[model samples]
Target: MCDQCISTVAASAGSRRRRLWDLPHQCHCPLVGVCFPLSTLRQLVNKALGGKAMADDYEVHVGAVSECLQRNRLSELLQKDLESRYASTVQAFRAAKTTKELAGLWADAVRRGDVAGAFWAALTHPRCDEVLQEVVLRDMHMLQHQAGAAIRVDIGKFNLLLREHGVLARELGKAQQRCTQLLAEKSAEIEQLNSQLVQQRAATIGKETRIAFLLQDLQQLRASLPDYENTSRLRKQLEQLAHRQAELETQNAQLRQQLGQAQRALSLRGPEDAPALASEPQQDPIKEAPITLHLGKKTVLCVGGRNGNLAHYREVIERAGGQFAHHDGGLENHQGALDAVLGAADLVICQTGCISHNAYWRVKDFCKRHGKQCVFVENPSTSSLSRSLQQIAQVP
Candidate 1:
């Protein structure tokens, strides 16, 4: 029940009083004609009719009477009732600040059917808009106070941090001053040490210069001394040494030739002539071939070499039953030329020196991809070239 309900009840009561007085004579029989006052009638109706239907009927009757009543008077009565109810509600809400007490009041008002009590209950309850607004305002004020306290605490912390930083800066300045003083002291000491070092180095340099001059003087004195007798004696001794050196050289050459001949004879006998050759062969002059090799025709790819070496290699290849092709150009274009020649060649021989790693890698890759036999050869001397040609001719 609220102020509006109470006002409505009052209006209904007045209307019912008027209705009772104005009843028609035909319907005024003792059983049908009720003469109770408006208050008593409402009580009886409430007792007899319970639940939502009865409440709805009571509301509708009150609304009809209110609509029919004089507007000004009804409004005055409603305003007075609302004011009184509101004052009582404000006092109750103030008294019962906590949500639990407000909730208890709400249950009591609903049971007792008190309109003002119900309004106060709603005003004080937690879920109600009016109560929620007041609660939010209080919480906001509390938060603002807490924020002020936190700000103060933060300010204190910041001040402490600044003080510490100032102290640290002071300490660092003192340390820097100490370091600068020490550096000045060390610089003076270093200057003294540098002066001493310079003196020592100068003394050492003077001694070395004196020693050099003395050595030069000694050398000149030795050079200026009469040396014809010593030279004649030394020349005689040198002649004797020369004769011994020539004898030793001749013996070394004969030994080397003997070793080479032994190696060649052993190679010619294969592996089974060890026990039979108890006596050594007599020394003889080395025989020479009747004719030298000639390069008439052949095809060969000459990769990396000096110009003179390349010409000699071309000649040797022609002698060895192969034609000669040459690539002499920039490092960048060499791989392409080598690849073309390798693809057309019967055999690939890479001159190991003077070729770049990129060229070697490309040539090896080409040979591997084409399943061609690739040989790496050192540059041949004239005799080695002849031997290589003979070996090539013997290849099946």
Candidate 2:
């Protein structure tokens, strides 16, 4: 249509609610561009053209439809579709009772990016005027230019972000691989430490077992001496023998002189005196013998003594020809065995200083009940044990 024809149409419509075909030729481009997607506009134009093929160019299609100033098949369809699509915007515009209020609603719609519905609703609004149309057109023109510049900037930023993302992704993959390698190395080290710990524990247990066995063997060897108690006594006897040797030699000389005197007298007194001298017995100088204690094979039970002196205690009883038995007085040995050991013993010797009161009582009670001999020795020496045995031996 020509500008005069468009001017005449605008003059004919006098500010009543206008239709899409009644809008000025300039309003067509913004309304068509904002209100419809390209694909939708293409379909609508194709359908309106009665299957006539439209050009593929977007501008070609928009230009062809923009010249529809009078109502036709295409213009009528577009008007119906816009009114239907923006019914709520139209109702909101209708609520504005003045030209100023309607313009405010149009500005608000533009700010909210709802220009499609607002543009259709505002131009077709009953309060729409020439001045409001010119203002809205100018605003839409500036907005299109700003949108183009923003699009170009966004495309450049998006490309930069794409390259940065690739670099960051490669760094993240390398970091994860290094973390996995460190984890594997740490796991191997932990396994090695655990193996060494197991070996050290095994060696420690073996050493402990060997030490216990050796300690038991040592105790047995200490208790195995047959004559340990006689060592000191024998040393004293040897010293006494050395002192008596001089006395024995002097006596031998005096006895030989007496014998010579007796022989001279016997020769003077003749054969009768010889028979008397021959009948008398001669004395020896070294006549003493060593004394030893004998127990006559009795089972002597000694309870409680110093652990180091246990060998001496055993040797004392054994040297006296007595069978030796002992208990550690509920210290190292079990207390339960005290009663059984007490029952089997012929004589009970208790070392009170080294024994528990319970074991002492048990020994005392057993010996008292059975009427067996019991000796409570305060000292745990071998001499005390020897004296106890001698006291028992002299009991008749």
Q: How do the residues 292-343 of candidate 2 rate in per-residue lDDT, one tens digit apiece?
A: 5576888988889775566667777787788987776887666876787788
How does candidate 2 score on lDDT?
A: 0.78
Q: 96-134 in candidate 1: lDDT tens per residue?
A: 455466556555554564433344334323333334324
Error of 1 at 39 (Å): 34
Top lDDT hit:
2
Using all chains and alpha carbons, the TM-scores for the candidates as numbered come to 0.25, 0.53
Which sections of candidate 1 miss by over 4 Å? 1-75, 78-81, 84-90, 93-298, 315-322, 326-340, 352-376, 380-383, 394-396
Q: What is the C-alpha RMSD of each candidate to the true structure, in Å?
A: 26.8, 12.1
Model 1 Cα RMSD, 1 decimal: 26.8
Considering summed lDDT, which 10 consecutive residues are worst modelled in model 2? 226-235
